[model samples]
Target: MGRRAVFDDPALRLANNLLDVGRADLHRRIVAALHDSPLEESYVGDVQDQLAAVVTDQRVAERDRREASRLIGIGDDLLAAIGRSGTVLMVWRRSPQQVDHPGQNMPLARYESDGIYQGSWGDIETFESSPELRTLAEALNWAQRRAPHVIVRPWWNDDTHYWAGDGPPPDGMDALPDHHR
Candidate 1:
């Protein structure tokens, strides 16, 4: 009898199917899918790097394998969440040093329909008819109810970089929005 081929594994085949998805589309799909997962802003970079390494090296270290597995699980969850219809509040920061304009960054909060990315202070821009406006407002409400002060500062907890929802924001941050404060 012939030995079983590695490609014969069902899980590997599923992963290969997911891997075949276009990079940008895959990311967008996953973000949209994982609307309710814990937001770990920093994991974005590390997970991308680790997953890349795993794909390139068949003999990757156990740590890389574990991280890749964890990310795959996240992707699976994200895929499962697709079309479920919900919100994911995103927050991010763009420092003046990062952009050409000086003193341009005022507040940092951004989102698509189903994901939230939050970080340091930055310019806030959104279309007048942006559908995510409601989601952003909801996140703000959640932050206020959860953390009455220091509304926008990012922090880390349980090895995840969470902002405004996981816990109280850092000290001295103006709780009110730009116009309000």
Candidate 2:
């Protein structure tokens, strides 16, 4: 065999932009970029211009740049996958019951035509459920279009060890929604 390829290749990583920063810096970068981008002019006639302006405005108190970056990251990952391969397989994390360290332990949800299907390693059964696109531009466009759905609900607190009351009952105990509290 010839020389084996190593894992940590420089070409593998996406260069830093507004996506790499913390919330405060991301908000600042977004505002600066908005001022310098075509969106400034095009936003005048755009339907969602007001909402975009709020996100891009430096004066906004709670800009929510973290959620913005997260949605953008999804598009970025899709693009990267398309760049490497013609198609990409996407997975969403679904947990009926809130669990600590969700990424490593939670079941994966694959979107299907009818509904979402969830399966875990230990379970022999798979749960089915309902839900996209092919091209990189289309993928990115789809992500951007769905960006508004990226609502950052407070799920858990590492400090207090508390999970959102809306989550499934832990240890099979009844858990009521916070709104009812």
Candidate 3:
């Protein structure tokens, strides 16, 4: 009939680290100690770290309120899911590919597989066709039609040395074979 301990509170209402105890009595005693002890003062830096952790975790638990921390809304969980850590992602608002005046929306290409991405048939048929590049072009055209003014690059602003015949597509796209070559 007694209220749940702060650590066991299902809603995770407490901001402090949860207590660790192997036995119920030990757990109760620890909680009681915390309850009885004077409040501990922490440095601003330590509190900032704690606040960041709580805010990050809070953003993870809440959907709509999880933005403004990053421009792309590409939060920590999304990066960790992809094996990226300790780095920030910059998402551009506009694309430059539209400058080429290419007419079509990007047709979701595998980037490496010449496998067809038909939105209708799929990569398997596209591979069988051996006209994978053509299919990708068609997809790009399709995407252009949908988002005419859109640029198609990893990031929106910086002109990749790509089309200029200078260099590559930038990081993370190394998996994609050098189509230009």
Which candidate has the top score in lDDT? 1
Candidate 1's residue-wise lDDT over 17-103, tens digit each?
Answer: 445543343334333332222333433354444355555555544554565565545544332322221222334233223545777
lDDT of 2 by residue, 109-158 (tens): 33222222221111111111112222223333333232211111112211
TM-score to native of every candidate shown:
0.22, 0.16, 0.15
Clashing pairs in 2: 114-130, 115-129, 115-130, 116-129, 116-130
After the best TM-score superposition of candidate 3, give how far the Cα of residue 157 lies from its true spot, in angstroms: 20
- Give me the overall lDDT of model 3: 0.27
Deviation from native of the Cα of residue 13 in model 1, angstroms: 25
- Model 3 root mean square deviation, Cα atoms: 19.8
* TM-score leader: 1
Compared with the true structure, all predictions reach lDDT values of 0.34, 0.27, 0.27
lDDT of 3 by residue, 1-181 (tens): 1112211231122322222212333233323333222112322233233334434544233421232233122222221222311111111122223434467664443333423322211122111111123333454443332221222333212333122112443453332234522
